[model samples]
Target chain A: MYGESKSGMQCAEFDLLMTDAIDGLLTGDQLSRFEQHKTACPTCSAMFAEAEAGLHWLGQLEEVDPPVNLARNIVLATSGLANEGARASLRSVVNTTPGRPLWDRMRDAFSPRTIWDHVRGTARAIFSPMATPRFAMSAGMAFFSLSMVFTVSGVKISDLRNLDLTPRNLTRTYYATEARAVKYYENIRLVYEIESRVRELRRAASTSSVEPEQENKQKNKQDQKSPKENEQRQYQNFSRQDSASVVIATFDPGESVIGESARQRRKL
Target chain B: MEDAQVVELLVRRCIAGDAAAWEEIVQRFNRRIYNICYRFAGSPTDAEDLTQDVFIKVYRTMASYDGERASFNTWITTVTRNLLVDHFRKTKNDRITDSIDAAPGESEDALPLSDRLEDTGPAPDAHLERRETRELVQAALQKLSPELREAVILRDLQDMDYKEIAQALRVPEGTVKSRINRGRAELARLLQRTYRQVM
Candidate 1:
């Protein structure tokens, strides 16, 4: 019942009136109206009471002593006086020199790192474009080279004059005859070496008198027989090598044939 | 020197990078700044740190000072209030409790009568029952929202006018009034609760 007018005074409006009352700003008719509203509203009355208490409490908050060294520390931090040792050192150096320029004094006050930062900023601003130009030029050349390679390789310019017969049938004939010739020559060479080695071992076994020597000669003939066995192994290895080489050569021939066809188209 | 003369001298010395002038300035204002910080933060240690930070900020920004705009005290108080508000926003849950301990061996009854009188009339304690009631009132104040508390502190404790309080708080005078009223109401409820608890 006491706060019935609370709905009439919007919260914001009530708060404003309350503030005005605290500040002694409300007067005449406005003051009378607020008093009437407060007498009827428990909420507004409570707010006024709270405001009074808060003010009283704020007044009672005692001023505490600041830390003893607070002023000293603040002065040290703000005035750059903390670097007295560095300053003293610089002063001694300046004293040794009879007279120094104003710029030198200024430089002495600034730390090397600060100067370096300024120099680095200036250098970046002045030379940044020059530093990247080489890389930019290289990139441009690479792009140009790529485009030229693609254009030359992509365009089909062929001559009819360079076109030979298909020659696919002729390739098989030539490969077979070449392979037979190589195999025949290799076999004849291997047979000749084996027959000569057998004759040498038979003569050595017949001439030796001691049994140990004869046994040695027999071991020699057995060792000599290993060569003929190795020749057979070599023949097998050669056959594998020859087949691989033939496939590679055939692939190469096919590539050349494509190139020849391209030339022939251009001629035509 | 008068406060204005002192501020002018300190400002000149500070601009000239005089270390001693800066120290004197800190010593003069530290207590007032700390109290403001304490009222805002409700913690002694936080208040002390904040007071130091306020001084540091004042020193750094002294170059921006123009005497025509405001007095040095008003500028500093404004800075302290703004910093505290920013701090309050960051730590939304931090409530500033009035933790003023009673001075050792001090009793209300033993005190002189003149000490208890306000300019208006009998002191606040004349109507209240006991010294403990003051404590209860303080505790209730801690329960008020920050906006309300700030308004009350600025208007009542700091004795800033409504317009000045509004300006310091960067709010309309109407908004300031509303916050103060609501803050007062909340505090009264809290005090009532405390009174009941004590009973």
Candidate 2:
């Protein structure tokens, strides 16, 4: 489709090179090839004509004069040395009034404080969008949730002020934190082990009582089988019992052996 | 010192907490940036607000400007282009298509479209024609896609060189030229369709 024309340039090539030609970047053979292609192809010629006309019209679209107060407004907004907004009267006073006292101008316009204000104003503007109600609400909710979590864990704001700062005390505090974490983990592990043992005991007592009649019938049946077959049946029965115990464990009540231990200690 | 040096000195003063230098910077670029915004947004009001926003951003990020990497012009233009793109993204949903019936520019200097239509008195003098042409071209420009619109605006309207435009637009020089070419062709066809007599 992009086969070369008599001008040694394809239409697609002409289209690609047209921008350079319009920009006057093409010279020598490139320029000649482009011109020859444009002359030969009506479509490319029309396109080139349109682009030229467009560039000319655009060139005539002279730059518009900014609003009179635009500069004043920008200065007021950026500088923060004065009130912002299009307060034309104030802007005129700040912008047009000539012969302000040198000291006054220096203090108002050149002072480091004004620069600080400018910096502050810019920073504020950049962050203004982030100060939306939704963001504020989200932040407040986060803070409230954090405070609630801290309160539930027995952490107090006041406790932060009473912390010891000496190096010796700091080392002791670090070790204390480590010891407390280890103790908490160990307590959790002990509770888990106790819960599992109590669950196994409960399951053993319930199965022994509820299925004694079935077990007796199985024992009578096992007496008629070969010894090897009887042994396999026994192993299968043990495996089924272990699976039943696991199923019961999943439905175990929230009450743990820890509560029973406290009860026993009270009785003691 | 050259203009670039002067701008560099001004930027140094600005970075050093010179309020006067900041004001000077704003004054120098306000019209240029305002015009760019006006052409890009197709609204004088939005342009004014955008110009203020651009200057605010420039003030905030002045410390980051590097004269060694780009001239002040290119740097400021890049800043303006970025803000305009951001503005475009934000207002993409809210943008209403511009009808030729709507007033063009809506600034003090620009005559309303209705006023131009009613100017039955003598085939509008050169000043009026030029103003009408400006408004027509602006309206035509609003019809271009943002990519093409920005390319043409930076090249033909702002008169930035292609290299500076490439830097500001963060595109290859060839891509920039291609966009400008397409933008010009589209704009010309649009103007020819609408204001054939004027063109």
- Number of the top-ranking candidate, with DockQ as the measure: 2
TM-score of 2: 0.57
Return the lDDT, model 1, position A100: 63
lDDT of 1 by residue, A140-233 (tens): 9998888798678784336535555568856877898999999999999999999999999998877775667879999999999999999999
Residue by residue across B57-114, what tens digits does model 1's lDDT show? 7876665655566767777878888888788787775542333222211232333222
TM-scores of chain A in all candidate models: 0.29, 0.30
Candidate 2 Cα RMSD (Å): 21.0
Q: Best candidate, lDDT-wise? A: 2
- Listed per model in order, the count of residue pairs whose N, CA or C atoms clash below 3 Å is 19, 0
Instruction: Please provide, for model 2 over A91-157, each residue's C-alpha lDDT reduced to its tens digit, 9 standing for 90 to 100.
Output: 2234223467766766666556555555666676567657889889988999999999999999999
Per-candidate interface DockQ score:
0.24, 0.31
Give per-residue CA lDDT, model 2, range B1-199, as digits (tens): 8988888888777766567887888878898999899999988889989999999888767756766779999999999999999999999888766655455664446555555656667787788678777787888888888889999999888888888999999999878877887889998998776654432
User: Which 10 successive residues of model 2 chain B have the least lDDT summed?
Assistant: B106-115
